[model samples]
Target: MANTIYFDEAGYTGNHLMDPDQRFFAYGSVVTSDEEAKEFVESLIRRYNIQNGELKGGKLVSHHKGRKAIDEILREFHGRLLVTVSDKKYTLACKLFEYIFEPSISDINSLFYGVGFHRFIANILYMEFMARGAGAEQIFDEFQDLMRRPDDGKLGALFSASKHPDNSPVITQIREFAQYRAADIKEEVESLAESSVGKWVLDVTNSSLHSLLAHWGTKYDVITAICDNSKPLQESGEFFKIMVGNEQRLKGGFAGNEHPMTFNLSGPLEFRDSKTCHGIQLADAVAGAAVHVLGGGTDDHAKRWRELLPEMSILNILPDKDELDLRLGTARRNVVLLNELHARAKNGQDLIEGMPLLIARLTHRLNLPPIPRPVG
Candidate 1:
């Protein structure tokens, strides 16, 4: 029996920084056999009177009765949830520009950037961290202070100490963050002759897609992918082709290059209306619950979903402030970004505009940031 993954994302506002009310874009899936998905949908349509419009997390928030209906369906639906949500702030995408280019309150084109930026930063960090290993997990203060004095010959020593080699392009790539120290850094990045912020953003997205394809292709036998009709990667046949190639550039993340596998998909991924597909309907709820927890929600529903995630499926990609010295699991992704952030700060460089709260967060850390302490 072939397995299918019904995919949906919640709180996707183009770019996380673009949405004032929300700051995350979650890519979630409900995995089951093809026959199981169909049967569940049939049951949902008959049982909940679910219309063939569109099932959405926003709608599910107030649809407690609808939620109850979904819980009932899933008890017999037989599927597991798989999801990845990008916390844009921690993911290290530049959001400094949003401050300058804030669209009018009524501007319908406000959230145009989407989650591409978040993925871009995430994939970059994952790849770079893997190449450097323990070397990548530099003390934040050391890199932060080093960036302030780029002319110091210690740069050569630091590069020499890195496992990736001093002359490798990775050095240049990692150093770019702290290279700018004066003037309008936001405009500077936007006008960079080498790369526009847009190019960097797209590059990050492509890298992330490449890494994700690697992750998915190896982990599951995804026969059919029923994604939302509106997601950016929903109908991306060409995008997938270019990204999921057998190039040496793809692998990375916490797990490293051990499982550099290709796609085992049976056919082209399809997008469907969640309202019609009970799988996506439920996927949205799970994604919504995950986001709720990420955003510090403390409601009864949030508590319920928190209890639902199996430890294996609950991947925490963010860094634990207490354990910055150790590099393991998903925290490797954060280590890459934090190192770059510190590098940039030391060099007196400011990140590009539109970074959501990252600009403030970094500023606090670079200036006199608090070291996170465990409460007794």
Candidate 2:
């Protein structure tokens, strides 16, 4: 039977608003053989221990309950919970901006290359499956079936690099940076894309966003989420609302931009719309996708490897409780953070704290090669 896959993104804030230096974006696909999709879902329900129609015990709790609920759950559960934390790498990278080293395209590429390649491959696999004759209905059916299942031991995940393709000047700056350390960084990048560690890095960076999109995309057939860093929130929201509300405008204006196989849960959700859905859920989905890939399954899988991995144990250091209140106070909070980080660098102040700790934590979590300490 032909394989079918689902695609979605997590942690993408459209305009690098949340973390300027680290633009967190993830694209994940749930791929399964048409015949196996049903069985896969059935297996997931039992494995994740969903009972009475409620997800229980393990990472499933956080996923079903929402971010605030996750924080509560983590606080209560404490030891070795199966939860996926948001990008500690991004948080750490944001801290790197204060170190006075010029950032390069490779630096950004290294971060995202680790993030996007696996999911991109997953997408490629879907294309490969489609080329073999899987119909859209089969694909959508498998995707939905997988979603309904409880968290299996696997988490479906992947990551992608985010850049303003339209902004050539910034692109040029990145390219210039690449020219200087192309050889060393390129080798590292190549290694990362192929390695399991690289795969997890991508997962940590993008899984949250991917999960949300997968959840929402599977719910609506004509999904049309955009990743633009240019538009203002109010403007973007009004535009999306008008588009979603008026099918005619979408049919006429958004025709070419639409996906080929329209399903029930394929409409667009704006990354900038706070009221639309939970950002952390989206991030978790991306993590879920990564876990799926790491665990190895046809389409959907459980978080077996993720649960065992040391990285899974590291507590996600979110914006401080006080900071969270201030940050989430406005619709444009993400954008504000991005602008603040960019602005603060000019004055040489570290915009975010706890970065070094994050890096050390992640390196240990992912089992990355130890960062070489400078010989004193």
Candidate 3:
């Protein structure tokens, strides 16, 4: 008698974010008893006063007062809500330039921090060029986000006295790191974005689901997950297994007292249409609301839906510079790693050439398996 989780995707674009129609990408789930799930759906049907096919977030939020009704139902839900949201713009940026950013970041903090660091560096570079009176607005335009997070102490030290020539030491260090190939970082990062959405699915699911499971900590003997029917994601299954079965990769994020016990499962995963299953609709509401709230939304009908809902675990995978962690320790590991790699290689080519050996060594150091190189 294992508990089941009804999973669903609110909005998804299999293609890159450039698609004009699809704006946000979200995947989420509701874990509860079958009885509770059934009751929830029945309650909704009775309240709506009509037979319906499925509950869709896009439609649920559309009516004049539909948003309020949706949130109220969600607030009364009897299970935990977990949602992973992505910013199409950010996802696309990382996807298109995988070489510069490692899209395979394990958690939300790292993803935002890593991307933040890259932008911060770009700003420093542009500033350096401008200092030499060679800065071109168009060149900076190539990277939309070039501002450093003002709160991060480390970057603060570097950019604080940027007006004074004496602060050139910190800037020189970045230039040096930029000059070195540093373990083929740019190439590795770029390649990390190869299957754009694939990387995103794996990382977001791993964090959101793992966080949910960990919160309970061995309370349930088995967890059955049912995702909304659609094109299957390769990582969805494996990454779920890692969190449930216990994998060392989570240590990078699960450390420091927030560790969760490994979750066990009973059988294979399932898929169902939301209209047919009311539980999944509940999951969709939670997921959709989480995304809207994280987007700096305050006026939506579900604003309270974003708040009063059950155990809310919202992973806002897309955060603006303001939403980014202000502390340097936020991404200390990636920062140090990037610095190390940059210090080792003299330029991008050297780093790229030495990548195989460097990644092998780094993964070995972390006791993790290396990402496979492409085969012929």
Candidate 4:
């Protein structure tokens, strides 16, 4: 039998990523049999005397009884829940990298992408932009505008923000690349805007769905993804279908080496109304509980709820604050690495021959012991 993955989301605020009220967006999924899902819902209604005949995580975690219900649900479905939370402002930073520093524009895109230069740069940008305040906002605002209507003015403004005096060396380097290769970046944006693909980058739901599907694809060769009806999911139905049909394994790579283990998905992605589907309701509760705790829930119960997650849930927080390290120590180290890679790429040097040197620099920054030279 094919595995079923039920999906739902919390903290969705559309393209207004920097909304102060809802700073985080989350996607949640629950994997269980029909009987299990039905029983879980019924059990919650009976155990908690739920009168609404539905359970929404956002509403439940606000009080005591509801929190207990969520706790029990976690215990009941251990290891079968997954949730991905993204810092909205940080997501914009990632979007900036996606469009501004697009790797696919060049032959070496794959190399940089494989090694997670995309992510490191995004992280660096997120931290810097958060510190620079208005400058970062200008870039995000311009980028969002460009997404809506591809205009030269918006593109120029976005690049201009990158040159903020407070921006680290990495940001300055990227700004230089964007200006020098303005045509290529602009063309990429125009193509995306024309295709309406730009929206997906900022849609946490879309990214989360991709992530959840990839996770399940590793365990189940065939999956039946059932998600709560969502605008992004509805719009991307055809895309999701094609993604699974290709049976593609979304893997990561570094230094020309690809990870063998990945989620190979070949299944159908379906959407259902939460009112009718117990699975979707369960997914809502799971997503809600996650957002509650991760979004600064400081109560005693919230702490307890967090403790239950390590065993049963996979909570992925995009560009965690720790990774961004306010002190800029980590970010500065990443800048050095990016500067080295950029130098090589700019000079048309052979990256394959230079991989070891790059790897050494990265390891040394992390304070790892050096690898011994191979005997000739």
State which candidate has the highest lDDT: 4
- Candidate 1 ranges beyond 4 A from true positions: 16-18, 33-35, 45-54, 70-79, 93-216, 219-222, 234-236, 242-261, 310-319, 323-376
- Identify the candidate with maximal TM-score: 4
Query: Which residue runs of candidate 4 sit more than 4 Å off their true CA positions?
Result: 103-105, 114-116, 132-134, 151-153, 159-177, 243-250, 255-267, 310-317, 320-333, 337-376
Model 4 lDDT tens row, 1-376: 6778889988888777878789778788888877889887888889898768888888888888888888787878777888777788778877777777663235545544544556777776677666764355566666666765674456655567545677556666766665655666778877766665565646778767777777767777777788888887787777676756456565654423333223434465777888889988888888888788778799887888678655444435467555445355444455665666566556655435665566657657776444433221
For model 3, residues 1-376, the per-residue Cα lDDT tens digits are 6678777776665543434455567777777766887786676656764336456666666564446656665667535666667765555444323333332222222433322444444344434434642322222222222111112222212222223344354344543442243233344433434544434532234444555555443456567766666554434555455544432222123223234535665544566777777777877876676556554566756566556533455434453443223354323333444555455544333333444454445556555433333211
Cα lDDT, all candidates: 0.46, 0.32, 0.49, 0.69
Ranking by lDDT: 4, 3, 1, 2
For 152-262, candidate 2 gives per-residue lDDT tens digits of 311121011212233233222322222333343335444545543332332232333333333343334444443322233223333234334332211111222222112
Task: Specify the poorest-scoring 10-residue window by lDDT in model 3.
Answer: 142-151
Model 1 lowest lDDT segment of ten: 97-106
Clashes of 1: 20
Question: Among all windows of ten consecutive residues in candidate 2, which has the lowest summed lDDT?
Answer: 153-162
Name the TM-score of candidate 3.
0.58
Residue 37's lDDT in candidate 4 = 90
Residue 257 deviation, candidate 2, in Å?
Answer: 47
Q: Candidate 1 at 329: error in angstroms?
A: 18
In model 2, which regions exceed 4 Å deviation?
1-84, 87-172, 193-201, 205-376
